[model samples]
Target: MDPHQANAMTTLSLFAHARALTAALACFGAAAIVTASGSTAHASPPASKKDSKAMTTSKPCPKGNLERSQCMIRLLLDDVAKTYDGSGGGGISAIRALNTTTFAVSLPQEGRIDVLTYEFELHPDGRVAIKSRTPSTQNVGPGTGK
Candidate 1:
């Protein structure tokens, strides 16, 4: 990725994180909105209205890492919680295309499930349709269920 584009992505991601922080803080006025372990941090409000227009499901995604940026992932993960097991618990970290069409999404390390990666592909019709979700394993760790 170009340095400028990388910078822009960083800026955009920071802005989004800030926005999430603001919304989270403002929502409850307490630090409970964010968790240090990241095991249970609440998601911020949806991107602003203009973000919808900026992020279209069409080809030629905006500048930056189109395949990995939050914009693309957010748009694609509209109903991610519906199918991705254990997705409801932790946050998403990365989205990498294993091939031209297949993508490997990195999920947060839940208790006893470290380095879990899910490979999926979107429908050719330009929608968030998952063709399949086969996972590759790594290792596990102890986690507090409390």
Candidate 2:
């Protein structure tokens, strides 16, 4: 083949190779990001033996002999789980009573290190409602830690 034609062919080959490499790299980068985000989406820690035992030992307050506050907390946690995760998986780690009808709760969410704090109130219809919520990393409300 002519020198000019050979060089042109080589250039085209190189361009094609480079384009294929770029596409492959982009696909790999996108896959990596998806994997990372998927991993971070469910950021709750694995349950330890002690934590598992604590969960098992603590029965649902209505059927068992647990305290009223404990039962209400369990129900609240269930509600939060339903609202946030669509499944009954998450649990509140800490709860502090603001008053007989109001309280603050702290729990961890997927992809976050800091706990989320929410103010909760018992409605007149016997339903629990979250009044307000704030992230714990910022200087916010009372239930601020893990």
lDDT of 1 by residue, 35-114 (tens): 22232223323433334452334333334343433333343343233334552334444444344334455444444322
Reference-based lDDT, residue 11, model 2: 12
Top candidate by lDDT: 1
lDDT of 2 at 4: 39
Give one clash count per candidate, in the order shown: 0, 0
Candidate 1 lDDT trough over 10 residues, lowest sum: 28-37
TM-score (C-alpha, index-matched) for candidate 1: 0.36
Q: What is the per-residue lDDT of model 2 for residues 33-95, given as tens digits with 9 covering 90 to 100?
A: 111112211112222223434222123232221133444444334333333431221333334
lDDT of each candidate versus the true structure: 0.37, 0.33
Taking all chains together, the TM-score of candidate 2 against the true structure is 0.29
Candidate 1 achieves a global lDDT of 0.37
Worst 10 residues of 2 by lDDT: 32-41
